[model samples]
Target: MNQETKQIFSLRKFKTGTHSALLAKYGIVLATTAALMGAGAVSADEVTTPQTQPTTEVVAPATDQTSANVGTPAQEQSAVTSDIPTSVPADTTQDQAVTAVDNAQTTLKDNVSTAKDTGVVVKEGDTQEVVINNGNAAEKTSEVLTDLNQQDKAVKEATEKQAANQKAYEETSAEHERVVKEGQEHLEQSTAEVYQLIDQAKKTGLLVTETTTDQTPEYKDTKGLTGDELRTDMAENLELYQAAIKAGIALQDKSVADLKAALALYQANQKAYTQGNTALKDAKSSGVAELEGADGRQGQVIDLAKKNDVTIDVKHETVTPNYTDVKGLTGDALLKAINDNIALYTQAVVDSVAKQDGSTKDAQAKLDAYLKLLADYQAGKGTQSGIKWAENTTVEAGTAQRMTGNEPAVSWGNLRTAAADAIQSLDRNQNTDATFDHIFKINGSGTVIIKNTTNGDVTLKISNIQAWTAENTYLAVWGAKDGGIAWGVFATTHGTVTGGAGEGATGGNVGATGAILAMVKSYDYEVSTSNAVSTVTFNDIDNNQTVTLNGLDGAKLVKGRNVTQSGNSYSAGAGDVSQASGGVIDSNGIQFNLADAKTVTFSGSHFLPGYINTSIVAGIFGVASEVPKEPKKPNLEVQNVDVTVPEAPEAPKPISVAVQKATVTAPDAPEAPAPVEVSVHYYKMTTTPEEPTPTPTTPVQKAAVLPETGEAGSILSVIGGVLLSGLGIVGVRKRKED
Candidate 1:
């Protein structure tokens, strides 16, 4: 082990009951408290957020060692980040002073040593003999103890004043930090609002101005363009959108710059406060070390005296501070009592140091002068007062106010119908009490607004239409009315149309009264032509549905006709139906077809014919009908014609073959067949191929057959004799068969 490690281990092995061990424990306590106080006084200057969103700052809690559930060292350190004072509290300072005095007194009583050999206790054999003499060294040691006890009081009072000053600095600095943070949060929120506004403008087509040239060259390469490129192209094409985006970006930059400037000031102040607190902490810690070191040296001085031949008489009693009680006294009476307490504590210092070594004589003289000043102040003779000096100065922290701004306009739209429909879609069984609080967007536009009010009869105003169009677009909003129809279409006129039908909540009719099936607001229709076909799309404030129309012949104008307005006066000329003459209905041009009909087709000469129920209305017409029936037939022509049939070819004929007869012939007489000869030969191989060795067996040989020898001869003889007779019979039989 290293020398340092061995020393530390040896120190740890000391008994807890020893005087040095107690001093070590108290020393550690003092050091720990000092470190914590220093750290806490400075950490408040370093608060910061880890995210873009504003964070609520939490003030650190101070540690109280007296609590039963006091946390572990790590936790205690964490909690002691702010509000902890670097200087000791008055109560703690007082306690330390009293404890130190008690320790000094006890040590003096225990150490039996003196500079003179008088008053020595000699032990001879089993008996102890005491030699008594008046010793000047013992008397001097007692006076020294008394003086150190008095010095403790002055240190305690000084500590209290330092603590109060530190508290004021901490509180004021914390307030300044809070104000700075609020400024930062305000800027962040302001920037966020600007961004939200820009986003809304981009989404609702506000960023897009009406461009006349559809096939602009810059957009021709859009097929392979990235997201940013596409946005840039659109912005460049639309002057208003481009301007809006620039404004938003500029606002964000300005807000951030302002925030940064404010933050810089805040950081500067925080740094100054932290540095000041750190300096104060260092001073307090040094003072504590000095006081404890002086206390430790007192014990060493007594130990040295004991080693010498001098014998000292120990004092058994400890000196405690005494003060005159002034309870029930008011004003100056109480003040006088406090002054006297200070004076008495001071005088003790003078008395204790007077008999000490000549080196401490200077300190004794200074204490005596201070005691005389306090006595004169009690007698009202001097202007210098100790009470005034001991008191703390009051400090007030500055105010911090949070910044405020108008809520951002995300988007606004006519949401009367959309709100109603969303409300209707909610589960009636589960949330019957739920009210409509939804916002719907204008079709193809960034503008969105919601009908937040619950009152049924209220009319909602649509704002900011001038940004999109100079022309006035009127809407006839329909809403649900009482009993006349389960579904009603209502219209309330805003512009020039007077005595308009559907003015109030009523049933469907041509004038003044219309069924309230749905209400459309802030509606607009856009048309574009390409390849001889014009596409028409309608956008409304109602978000519940949309309408799109395609395949309209460009040469002919396709019109919108409110099916409810059926009178001859409302009828449009061949191609006169336009945005100016309003006949628009629910999204997708969907209308409830309650009329009983066998077939229906929404077709016109100017448009490509398609099923009106399925194509134009998205088949909502089928469900909107009062009664279910066969689907509508598309507008087209059909006919029937006969088909020709051909006869099958005849099967192929089978092939034929002629039969031939076989005949037997008999040769003339008695030629016997010659006997076949057979012969056998044998040879032996020397080696086998597989084993490379051959075992030979006996070879048998037979002569070539000689007609089986005599047997064949005898058979041939018999056959020749029989052949002679058979030949004659066979010739006769063959002749008869032929």
Candidate 2:
């Protein structure tokens, strides 16, 4: 093997040796790749379903190194790209192949770093295969980069959704507040209107006193409330207020109408009373004028006798008519006294003329005129006074007209006895002849007659007296119908008379030759203010028949013990005779029967009529109905909005990427390249293990035990061992090549 032969032989030996070493290195690479692929291969069953939808993004390799903080989408893509090599160098020299292998190893480490930075969790007991092939390595790196970008997109979408939900919640809450405020205002206004109506009714006196307080509704305060609670309470309160307004207005209208009606009735009654009072006054004035004319005529008769020179003595000796003195008299007393004096004077003139020697024609004519005047004065029709004279008659039946505002003609006690005798005579059933005397009859304005035929001394007496005048004053009158009985007392305010002539009897001093000597004697009576009126009584000795007088003065009548007649009956122990035999007495009076000689009495009082008048006024004026008050407003409770604050999308739950190792062969390999283990990072989007909900009685449950994936520390140890073994093989091959 000279120089040429030796050179050729040396080169051949080196090529053979280099080929064997390369093949041995390839074998070692294949074996290591197989082991890494086997460790990284994870079954689909082991992987859990993703909690969220997976998003994909294709990431192109970057030209420049990027920041480690993968916070933004662009930053994340750049960071992942910085970890991957652009291309694999050709393995021509031993050092170059070693450098290429070193670059591949560095790429793998960078990818793992990027994975950690991007929040890709590498579960324990999981192996990753890093392919050193020129074409497939970039593809694997792009998968990891894509996962980072997809995670960022998911986070952005989640944040936008959360913002939209929050805005919607705010809008709903605002609308609810507006509705509540408006509703409350409406309720308050309605309540105020109702109160106004109530106040108006009271001020106008239209409110009914009896039910105003009880019917009035109370007000309620609503101070604190919010949201739907306030709205609902306001709605209910509004309804109540509206109802109160309606009812209050209606009540006011009714009260107004009632008041109008009552006022109208009161006015009508008052007008009627006024007219009646006027008529009463006119009638009283006419009686006074007629009585005055009678006095003038009596004077003329006396003067005419004197002018004729008839030798008629002014004083005649004869029984003079009973006459009361006319002095310091007023009202009905003065009128009666004057009339009586005139009648007595006229009688004196007649007696004196009869005793004279001759009576002149003028004297006779004047005397007759005086007689007619006297008769006219005695009857109630001429004087317009409430007095009437009934001449004595033999007939057993007669009628008398009822007269008002009249005084009694005779002593009431004596008259009662006479009436009792007359009534009792009817019960005797006797046939003896009887004389019926005309007695004074008195009552309200109407005619009432008494007819009886009997044998006993039948003396009839009827006395019903009343004063028709204004509220505070009254007029009363009384006079005898005829001069039949003797020795009667006539008392008046002016004076009194005690002794009088009997019926058809005359007495006086008379001279001889038929000449009048002295005036006739008059009745004797005691003058006293206290004995002005006689005591009136009714004594029934037989205890039989009942006497009922109806339509008496309501103010004067009083109910005695056991009185049974309606309308202010004063009889004691009387039977119920409201419906009497003659007719129903629809006015104030008394009913009584003579039981065991019982006597009914009367007493005067002035206060009762005034009280009755007051009652009438009250009935006319008081008319109204109750006024209702405002209804209560409801109290609303605070209602806080149940706002579910949307969580800030949880940052897309840190998309979990499964770093799986896969083997791929290079299509452009000069020889069979070692099977490359590529770590393809993808977003599995698995959820973190959640803690189970705890029951009321049990303690909080811990996070569910995740499926056993080896611990992180052990996985790192396996990776370290695999890396060391690969490095050792490269170093040995390099040492041999050197």
Taking all chains together, each candidate's TM-score versus the true structure is 0.12, 0.20
- Residue 324, model 1: Cα distance from true site in angstroms: 99
Candidate 1: tens digits of C-alpha lDDT, residues 1-738: 000000111111112234233333433333333333333321223222121211111111111101111233323421211111112221222223333334553432222122012222212122112121121112122222223222222222223323333343344334434533443354446556545544443343233121111111221223323224433433343433333334444555554453444344334433433443344345335433443443344334434334432232322222234665544433344445545544554444333323232222222222322343344545543211101101111111112111111212111113243222222221222112222222322222222111111111111222222111212212112211110001111122222211111112112222212211222222222211111101121211121222333222222222234321221111222211111112133322323221222221122111112111000101111111112222211121111111111111111111111111111111111112121111111111122122233443644222233234323123224433554454345435433443
lDDT tens digits by residue: candidate 2, 139-250:
3333333323333332322223233333333443354345434543543454444445444444433332323311223423333333244344444444444454445545
Best by lDDT: 2
Q: What is the Å distance of residue 353 in model 2 from its true position?
A: 43
Which runs in model 2 stand beyond 4 Å of their true positions? Answer: 1-160, 163-178, 188-738
In model 1, which range of ten residues has the least summed lDDT? 1-10
Error (Å) of candidate 1 at residue 592 is: 76
